[model samples]
Target: MNDTATPLLDVRDLCVRYETSGASSWRRHLTTVLRDVTFRIGAGETYGLVGESGSGKSTTGRAILRLADIGGGAITFDGQDVATMGRRTPLAYRRDVQAVYQDPGASLNPRHHVGRAVTDALRRHGLGSAAERRARAEEVFVQVGLTADHLTRYPSEMSGGQLQRVAIARALVLNPRLIVCDEAVSALDLSTQSQIINLLMDVQEQTGVSYLFITHDLGVVRHVSHRVGVLRAGELVEQGETKALFEAPLHEYTRSLIAASPASHPQGRDERRAARQARRRAGVGAA
Candidate 1:
């Protein structure tokens, strides 16, 4: 869908399942989490995957990060079959693909200095000497709007926004081609969320990196994504360019989601509320 010469990430008919415990230990059932999920992200592009809870949005990101087992289909990254990659993922791939989770504080160890998060990643990849790694860490910290001095502080010493910036620096230090942002901004306040979203866009413009942004916040998706995908019950119900999808969604589920998203301004609050009430009375998208 990106129409790039070659997409940075391509997922086709991806299927993921997990075995659930049944009535007895000897009996188990396989529950499919993703079914025929497909999408593509190009270099420097942001693809927003949006859905409510249990919609398989995060599962898709996990599959791409190689943290989840793929039950079927193919995931090709930069022309390589990621799904077929053996249990031991390549170090190059590890460096090329990184993740920034929702809880930045939890992502960093409470015992270690915040700087260690970036330095440790560099050390694992054998990128540079200790001095070089430290310097690189400082540079990326500044890039994410944090001072080099802040790196010496512990996670508990910083605010949520600051911690999130540190997490972004850690992911950026690897110079990754793509980053899976799993609800990366959902934990922050409105102002902080806007700042982080802008920071990500600036970083992409400067680095040509791709993003697979998985979140339940449609407002954030509309603000940050170039393209959007709506997932329901482990399947993609609709996907298209951001403007078109938001303005004229084709699928019933997609329309319902858009209608349910809080309006950006107060100008049409009463009108929108009345429309929702009408839809509810008609038994449309009822909970």
Candidate 2:
């Protein structure tokens, strides 16, 4: 939120391409998944990437985390070009920029106990000895609203929400500065989703971490984001302060996205939002 400070993550003109088979039997060509996408997540700020399914939101997250190839552009984090980070610095980068994936079930190793999986990353980073790391892992469990004792349990034993809590705990164990939460609560029930959202806010509050929250749910973005960027067909159509964008959308694509959202003001849509904006303007007029 500091105005004079540099951004925590800056991505410029990023592009990604995925190869798909052609109709003709023996041919393939690259399909662009993200097209000249650019954005920034500031220190201790939540930047929401809003879009529908297959809008390349996930691809952007994967590319930022180095899980996918970057066919073009540059991503810089903490003043270092992440793409140029060699073998010696990758582990360090991984420690600073962590990810909470969409499917916790698939992301977590089924064979490992939840506690072990969380601790493995901490140990790999050489944060602590066995005893210290175990204790740290337990502390993170309670931080994410999970009992320390559940560390012994395997991923297969937990529900989707619980598995996500474990995943969160794992990410927290490393004490990351920035986290890419990719549909982290999409699989949970509404009540459970609220719990996770609160947990993420609390974690950000206490740890001074920022989140790149990618979701198709505008309602969720409205609740959690400081600023929102709408992506359509691999390109960012519009972005601004969340309230400003919600109240007065300049782009038709953004308005369409707001319309498509299920939880948006259903019947009145633009009318209600416009009324609120009018009131604010009238209040300023009086002042």
Supply every candidate's count of residue pairs whose N, Cα or C atoms clash at under 3 angstroms: 0, 0
In lDDT terms, how accurate is model 1?
0.90
What is the per-residue lDDT of model 2 for residues 1-287, given as tens digits with 9 covering 90 to 100?
A: 45477999999999999989999879999999999998888988999998988999999998888888888999999888976654345787889888897788886778888899888988898888999999999999998888988999988888888999989988888889999999888888887887788688768878889999999889888878888899999999998988899989999989988887777423122343466578788784311
RMSD to truth, every model? 9.5, 7.0
lDDT of each: 0.90, 0.85
Q: Candidate 2: deviation at residue 79, Å?
A: 1.1
Cα lDDT tens digits, model 1, 1-287, are 44747898999999999999999999999999999998999988899999999999999999999999999999999999999886799999999999999999987899999999999999999989999999999999999999999989999999999999999999999999999999999999988988888789779878999999999988888877889999999999999998799889999999999999996422122344466688899989621
Best by TM-score: 1
Extract clashing residue pairs from model 2. none
**Candidate 2 vs. true structure, TM-score:** 0.87
Candidate 1, run of 10 with poorest lDDT: 264-273
